[model samples]
Target: MNREQPDPPAGGDRIRQTAVRAGGDVIGKKVEHHHPAGPVTALHALPTPPAGFTGRDALLEELLAAVDPTTGADRAGVVVSAVAGMGGVGKTALALAVGAAARQRGWFCAELFVDLRGHTPGAQPVDANAALDTLLRALGVDVEKIPPALEERAAFYRSALAALSDRDEHRRPVLVVADNAAAVEQVRPLLPGPGGHRLLVTSRSTLHSLAGARRIDVDVLTPKAAVALLAAILGADDSRSGRTEELAEVARWCGYLPLALEISAALLVRAPHLDPARLARRLAQEGRRLERLDDGERTVRAVFDLSVQRLTPGQARVFALLGVNPGPDIATEAAAVLTGLEAEEAEEVLQDLAGARLLTSHPGGRWSMHDLLTDHARHHLTHHTGTEVEAARRRLLDHYTRLTADAAIHLQALPGEAVPATFTGTADALAWLDTEFPNLSAAAYAAQHAGHTDIAVALPLDLGVHLDRRRRFDELISLSTLARDTARTTGRTKAEAAAWNNLGAALAGVRRFQEAIEAHTTARTLYQQTGDRHREANAVNSLGAAFLEARRFEEAVQAYTTARTLHQESGDRRREAAAVNSLGLALAGVRRFEEAVQVHTTARALFREAGDRHGEAMALDSLGTGPGGVG
Candidate 1:
């Protein structure tokens, strides 16, 4: 995974000058050396559309319809279309496909192409003035005769296209495809003048500054399309239909990006016996996904490196911070904490990263990195950057811990309880928890894995009340287990006892009463050993509830009787009243009718003293329903 070769130099080093045009396409080129400013007898210089190119049917139609008009009416200006996306998302392939289609339609008599080298490695982006020199020469103007200044060269370049279009007969409709432009400045000067001509640009950036340009955003291929493309590259036929599912899995591992897909196909092609299943298993390892996508000549990491190379230092740090975000996406506030930036500053940096296609922005100002890109950023964080990964993770976990504590306060509050100042009310706290639950869950796991034992134990404990209130017992069980195991590892006896109590409640929630009783018993014993009478009383009360659910009424009665005494000793009047009510229910379950009524009466008096109207109503109901009562 650490093989660090520089990305292949783009544009300048890859251009083929000896390539000749035939039938409106670059048919062939001599490998012999040619000058940089060589003469072009034919204007067609579009690279051959990739072999077996597949998909993008709808997008292809959209681009073609925009570039080639149905009527003979003149356009207001040159029809400029820009295809933008993250690296390896097939921007160049789609643009080249459009160029080939336009050529076949005979919409243009001549074509010109340039590689602006905007994000190339080990080389600077082609300068605007230098790009003009290249374009001017391709238009048949001698290098010595071309203007020196950028504006003069641009004016002359536009007029040359205008002159070709202004002809009375044999007027030319030229297509100038500017590939790999990093900025608007590199493209602004290259727009052909008004005629029926057009300019198509492909960039990793959104290039939103291009006025009136029809921007097409290319994302990863869909699973069906990715599989089809992979099959095409592998030349699989109907005989291999059984491998469709395996191939689809490989496509997912590749993130369905075209460049990665092509390299995966190449690996299979070279090995011949490496099946899709084995390849998928290798790719499933996140640490090695980008590594497995390489085929000697081209790598997904190399493509991504070029994009990262273009980012500012501040942006690069933020990008690395995002790598360790354990959830599907991160909010602006969380990102602010992770990067040690103000929310406003972090948001601006996030927007800039989105514009560069390094991150994807979602509604409500959240941002997410693509799977492969996240791996790359983590690699950068580990090897290339000065940022401490553990420190960043701690900040993130602490941020989530504080928010969860605030939410828990509101969740556990009784009716008419004062809401915390951190949240407006119960609804606000609940809403925050609902939105941040996935992130919170991930952060808890991250803390456990990173050995942040205290936060790991505290977070799940804080989430217990909320999960139980929502009846999400499955999630509650999971967090409780994490808290229990994590605490056991650190020998935090008090924390482990608390976690067992929570686990007991969650198990009872799902009717696993035997397991619930065992957990609560362990918690009670631990509490007794620690000399905590209040928590011990709480654990006994939970154990009583589990026994009652399991219909062990005699055992429930004994547990509640002891629990009632513990609560009284601890001066917990409301819990004492609760224990009395449960004791009455157990008495009735064991057919001790008169004792049940007498206990219910005492429970009613206790609830009245404690101002627990809900408990009093429950006790009155129990009195009526007891054996041999008024009913």
Candidate 2:
């Protein structure tokens, strides 16, 4: 092999020259090569599905059936199901559940998830054009090539889906999960036309106007299901502690709402020895319920705040007032009164709230908020409304005060007395008072605490008679004390006198006659200083009643005489009649029968002149039965 062979023939020279020429040509020109773009095999952009998702079996099944690709060939367009509910009602959870199930079933090759940030706190909703750009980019469209306008972007998205559908190798169905969609238009451009694809949307609103979208309203879990969820979260060891009843109570206190249940369960899971009964008792307090439901990052209040942030200013104001409202539910007219809105306008606002699931509508044209939502609204009112809160509260108090004062005049006004034009009859007045009794008390307390002195002073004066008639002495005592303090702080002498007078009445109702006398005496001095002869006369009359109750006859007679003289000077014949009747009782208390009889005769004449048949009857009965008859 190593031996040199004979030199090649002269043909080698031509071969070398040809080879050199080929090398020079290759070196002088560039080579061009082409490769095709690879297909997008899979996309997993959805959030991980919630863990241990419990209940909602029916809703889940319906959602799964809605987006199942096998049925796409039989349908006209891509199936769209809108999952809507109040915040924390598990709207996103249901959508994720269906999405996970679909992925497991191999329903789609291209998957997409976008948080529209519709009602997210501290974030504006995604713009439709921007959202479309996101979808185009997600579909492998280059940023520069993607259309800038919404319509073009939408067209491009559809074309992309069409191209994918036409490719036999990549013609797998697509699944899009749009979470927290704020508005219809925000979602419109993102939806695909008729094809082997589906979209599942979640929002606080129903998005009812979105054409061809099936809506599923996700409500709170059923009681059995809620308890089961709590148990599932607690695991075996904690759930079987003979505290099943307490667990049920815990769920009930959570309103059987899934979000609340999970938060409550988390607390128990952290403290393995913590009694379920203890947690139940803790949640029993409404003021503390929302606080207890917080777990640092995911709070019930935080969940509710997002929905509240989306409200219009008027709706937000109405919601704040609803928080301050003491009733379990509100009639539209009542809400109108609370917010100073026209009834129709207020109803529209309430319906908007109901549509947003911040409020729920009952059959009787009334609206109610969930217990936790009410707390959240109040929280917002306390922190965000600022000076407007004071003004709004004043308006609420003024509304209730005027209506209640009118009601009292209708129910308790003496014949021939001028009263506010209100109520169809005494029965109507009584019914209104009975229905508003608790609210009236709550308003009075709230006003006093918030330093609205006028409202506090006026409230008990209007409500006292009804409360006395109903034997609601506890509320009377509480309201009157607060009124006294508030009036004194504001230095309104007439209001202070009125507050003391009401306080005396409440004290007497509870059989605290000594304190009642002291209160009445204070009232008399304040009235005299203010030069209010009529109220001074009223105060002296109350002072006499308290004296008589304490068996101080001489003091009682002296008090009644002073009241009678003042009433006569003030030209209040009706009250003069009342004072004269009381003087007769004091006279009988000291065994002065002759003077008592003369006083009684004078009282009878005054009562007749005043057209007070009831006062006349009382005076006649006193004449027949002596001192005991007056009371």
Candidate 3:
């Protein structure tokens, strides 16, 4: 190790004399100054251990093993372990406990701790130069002899640790804890030399840039642990002993986060008459949850406020826009459109936020914020940039609308038909639809809520076929109702007719035949008024199918005959063939066997002409079993 020892005064004087102009003993005399009378013993500057530091038994054991001096002696360098987690998860508490435990185990002869203040409210992080000065002073270097620049000070700090490690009389290492570091740069220079000294850093960020550091991620407490912590804070003789369920509910409202739990516990301790069940009710209201989380001094909101204070302008904009997203998670491309950023730029910003623990990245390249953090982001957007929220939500809805429309083409394709080449195939299209279905459903509702009725109608209309294919009748019914009401309110007659048809199909899927018939009848009437012949034929065909399923053969035959005529007039030969096939089945339903055979033959010819092999095969099968094929 480079022992660049501190040099004495340049004059080679063992003692320096300074004039004392106004002292009680000497008014105009020179006073001699000397170094401390004896050698400086090992320093102890760590804060007191956190009160009621419960749980995390496995994590504590693992961290202790990582820094055990006996195990670290095999390695030539100092051990650097970082504790990273979201704010209010107790990273600092864990670090402090580890430092104290290490000292008690005789793993180190001295302990030093400093708060980097990385996420402290209204405070900037302590720079590396300033941190090194603190560490050097604790290591027995005089303030006057400490170096000026960061590099020199770091070397001096390491050398002092090395000197302590090399001493035959006291060869144990020193335990250093750097708490609340915002970035890796703040703690990099504080690393000790290759002498087995240990450095433990606690931060809201993961600090991935620090090389060779063992990262221990801290998360929220388990439900049992959270309740245990509450009891610990409320004392052993509190009257709320039998109310475990209410206590658990309150913990659930706090999201099992340590800081929120601590604050809630403090509130109960201060107000002895407050009921735990009542507290749970107040926190169950999400709008008032954060308000109740405050104890007149510290708040969950203030803790989150500090986490976002250091974000760049772009990151801040994107973070605020996340509040407007209704889905539980957002894909990268979707977030890009919502934030008006390029896909690549949005990905980088998302990863940065993940590093800062503000967002969590999932397996499919999606990101999500914690429920409490999302509430804070929503409040931030409402107060800081409310004007852009509508635009951002509109952009997100439009993006889903376009993608859903594209996926619908594949869902509507026939068995022997080709889909659009933009999609790989039917399977790929289905996967995209499956992944985005939740977002699309949420977007449709959000559009209606935001008064964008056109998008609200278009989105569910486009998703109708997929919802039917997946047997998601409940979701289909929900969105269809929204679309139907939104269209009627906005005077969109054509969109309303389409929504009615979709609702009819979903109702038919669930065997609600009478309601389905009523929905299709209204749709047919609307199409007739609009002079849309092709859609009128579609509505009539759907009406015939509902009649056939309801076992009303005569009404089915009448609806199919009219539908066939409408399709012929519109020059939709495929739909005409479909109507003819349904007419044959209705003929057999009423026991007209020979008439059914003739009608099936004609339908087979039309299906062959239309190049619909699947329809033609069905027609031939109907011809083979003339009376037996009736519904």
Candidate 4:
């Protein structure tokens, strides 16, 4: 057997740990440092979970949907899920339940479970090569004959597993459960190639980084459900079943956590003298009651410690910084700003944190720790890292402001002048706007709170085109009003005109023409007030269009004529021609034959001079079929 540690980057690699698994809780001293190097030629297939555990009906359905056989090989694709919730949430129990359920359903030819030990304090994760070696052996490879080097071992591992799943597009079913993984890459090498087998993984952290993987958010068990679970575990015979209600109190006190409940039950077994009544009373204390309530070495803190202790200094620092973020998660870019790492490096670190079960990655690359974990991370940040918690938060918020402002501008405007967005992830970008829609509104509200009136006004105005395209009319109304009020607050003349114009357009899209005309008139008035002659002309032009649509011909003529005078004054002959065209169309509506002909004639000459063939043709067509033919 050859032993060399897995080559983790300078401070980011692996070391072995020896922890005692007491009642499925990892408990033990930290092993002296040794790299968890290359795989063992010797192999051992692991034991499968026994049948029957409660919970996870919803999880199983989602997983089955993700890996449906009708979807065929993709069904056999990696299904990474996180059983994330507070400390007492039944994440591990849910994993065990799913395992038991999968076996009970007879879905796989064989089953294997390996704990990646990502969240364990000092426990080193099982390496991919070592995992594959064990997989091949479990599939019945002889220890002496197995290959040694990484490449050969992987090939043999893939080949030996290939027997269970032929090279054909579809094959036999096997289910591999990688329990408690720390990263997307770590679980990658062990994936059985295009086999009929499916892998159902359970982790404390969300694994959204894994494409085509199903994510199931495990929450606290319901009060009724928790009571039922304790009843099933701690029944004092049929006669003493009145104590079912007592277990309910125990469940809540333990935070409806399945692991905690199991431990609470184990303690009752360990101490025969303690009554369920007394145990419930002891757990009710507000202090660090976790020590008293724990099932044994498998307390929530203990489970977390194994994963925490395994981290190198840098990875440890990242976990600490993330705990202070305001929201449940931060985008990878924001995390990069917080950690002073580049985006790619930040993503890799996030994956490590997630794989270690110290943090969770959500659908849009947002990272968060379980609430209790965040509290722990905050404590560590205060005492260990020299970086200020507030400083990291301030930097993250600044980065978010810059990114969101940039994105808003890119999303707005006609494509002619706007920059093409180079998004980190196209799927991620869209999902970020969608998932953070509420947060964006809150951000707008926050800008006002910070007394940044210009940003408050400009940010919403910047979103006009995208909102129009998306038809989020209600949001448009809200944002438009925010822009309008903000500009007013800052006495920003140009911004007032812009916001009023946008509000008018948005109102018009919803067919509130009267409100649009009123708003457009307000914009025109503001432009005129500010002596912004060019914007005044443009606003008048918009007003004319609206009047024409509303069948107010006389009003339309007045607006168009005013615009024509301004364009003429500005020497913008093309716009001058457009206004003359509008005047011609309005004149024809009122049967002013001679004036209409005169207007069309001017428009034709201007179009010809401008080399606008299409406009010239339109003018010629209108002039010919008019009430009075052009002389």
Candidate topping TM-score? 3
Score residue 406 of candidate 1 by CA lDDT: 73
Better of 3 and 4 by lDDT: 3
Please provide, for model 2 over 372-429, each residue's C-alpha lDDT reduced to its tens digit, 9 standing for 90 to 100: 5676678777754566666666777888888887766555555455556678766677
> How many backbone clashes does every candidate have?
0, 0, 0, 20
The stretch of ten residues in a row with the least summed lDDT in candidate 4 is: 20-29
Task: Give model 1's clash tally.
Answer: 0
Residue 106 displacement in candidate 1 (angstroms): 41
**Residue ranges of candidate 4 with Cα displaced over 4 Å:** 1-54, 58-254, 258-330, 338-340, 356-359, 362-440, 548-553, 571-631
Inter-residue clash pairs, candidate 1: none
Candidates by TM-score, descending order: 3, 1, 2, 4
Better of 1 and 4 by TM-score: 1
Model 4 lDDT vs. the true structure? 0.58
lDDT tens per residue, model 3, 1-631: 1100011112221222111111000001111112342323336877666577897788888888877877745332222333343576877778878888887888887788876767643234667876776676567665445555678779888888878677736698877888878888998888785777888888777777887677778878899998888888788899774478888987777677776776566556656787888766655554254565453213465445544555677877788888888766789999999998999999999987775557768767888775556766777786454567888888999888887766666554565454457577666777788777767877888788788888998988777766654535556677788888998888877777777877876676556889978988988888789987767777787787777777788998898899889879978676677678778878888988778888888988998998877667767766655333532
Better of 1 and 2 by TM-score: 1
Alpha carbon lDDT of each predicted model: 0.70, 0.66, 0.69, 0.58
Candidate 1, overall lDDT?
Answer: 0.70
| Candidate order (lDDT) | 1, 3, 2, 4
Model 3 clashing residue pairs (backbone): none
Q: How close to the true structure is residue 458 of candidate 1, measured as C-alpha lDDT?
A: 90
| Poorly placed runs, candidate 1 (over 4 Å) | 1-293, 296-298, 383-387, 613-631
Evaluated against the true structure, the overall lDDT of model 3 is 0.69
Each model's Cα RMSD: 28.2, 37.8, 30.9, 22.3
lDDT per residue as tens, model 1, 145-196? 4554568878888887776556626676778888888888898888776777
Better of 2 and 3 by lDDT: 3
